[model samples]
Target: MRRAAKADDNQPVIVKSFRQLGWTVAHTHMIGRGFPDTVVSKQLPSGLKFTAVIEIKDGAKPKSSQALTPDEVVWREAWQGEYKIINSIEAVLEYHDWVMKKF
Candidate 1:
């Protein structure tokens, strides 16, 4: 379990780590409106841009019931983002590696 207050805290760590690896990343789940959890862009040395939106949740699983919730489902459908449920800072690091590989 985790405090809701810092639930999305993984956003910056992931962003910074990726940036160190030379990825251009932004927090874009907001699409503006202050909702973006993390938006990452990778501009290859070749000038191609790869953009990915990541939503980070700490210490909680995304309940199917919640996903079925009206607004949640809507965002899931429209955002094309990822729901990452992590329990610790280490999880965030590991998950970041996994997601990058996935992309």
Candidate 2:
């Protein structure tokens, strides 16, 4: 299996890919909102706002042998807006598409 990516590595990759596609993105922690991994502002070419909280993680699927990590599960459950769990570029683009369609 591929090794998991550290936040240091994954964060920039996610940001760069989405920003290049024209989304306004930020690392959530940097904004003093200690919640998601990234915050994305989905916009139309005409600049309408479609925003959501996003969480990114690079890991194997959660193992049945172990219980959910409390902190991770808490954030996952408590998020109050459109949210997605993404691990690959396809998934990110899928999310952007879904946001555009929904909001």
Candidate 3:
């Protein structure tokens, strides 16, 4: 059987949405030893800036291979600040709005 292909393409989609919303997104997420998949940043109108880490996963499948590893859990448990494990573009947009209210 042909495995799901586009399922692994969610990362680019998330990145694009973040860019559309005026946030700077990077594919190299070196934070916490590269536990996250993407790094996102934005400067609000008030000159307030914030950085966030996102871990993208394909939640469309019940048994998707995007589950976090043990290392990721350990890092996430110790890290601080904005972080999220997103599965869809809508979730990314929703989180963006939620984070915007913080600054």
Question: How much lDDT does each candidate structure score?
Answer: 0.52, 0.65, 0.76
* Model 1 lDDT tens row, 1-103: 4223232455666556666766666655444332436666665554556666555554444554223335444565676545543334566568656655665
Residues 1-103 of candidate 2 have per-residue lDDT tens digits of 5343235345677778788778888776443223567878865765678777766655344535223346557776876677776665777788777766765
After superposing candidate 2, which stretches have Cα over 4 Å from the reference?
A: 1-8, 29-34, 45-47, 59-68
lDDT of 3 by residue, 51-102 (tens): 9888878767565476776867887898897889888889988988987886
| Per-model TM-score on C-alpha atoms | 0.49, 0.69, 0.79
Q: TM-score of model 2 relative to the true fold? A: 0.69
**Largest lDDT belongs to which candidate?**
3
- Estimate the lDDT of model 3: 0.76
Candidate with top TM-score is 3
**What's the lDDT of the predicted structure labeled candidate 2?**
0.65
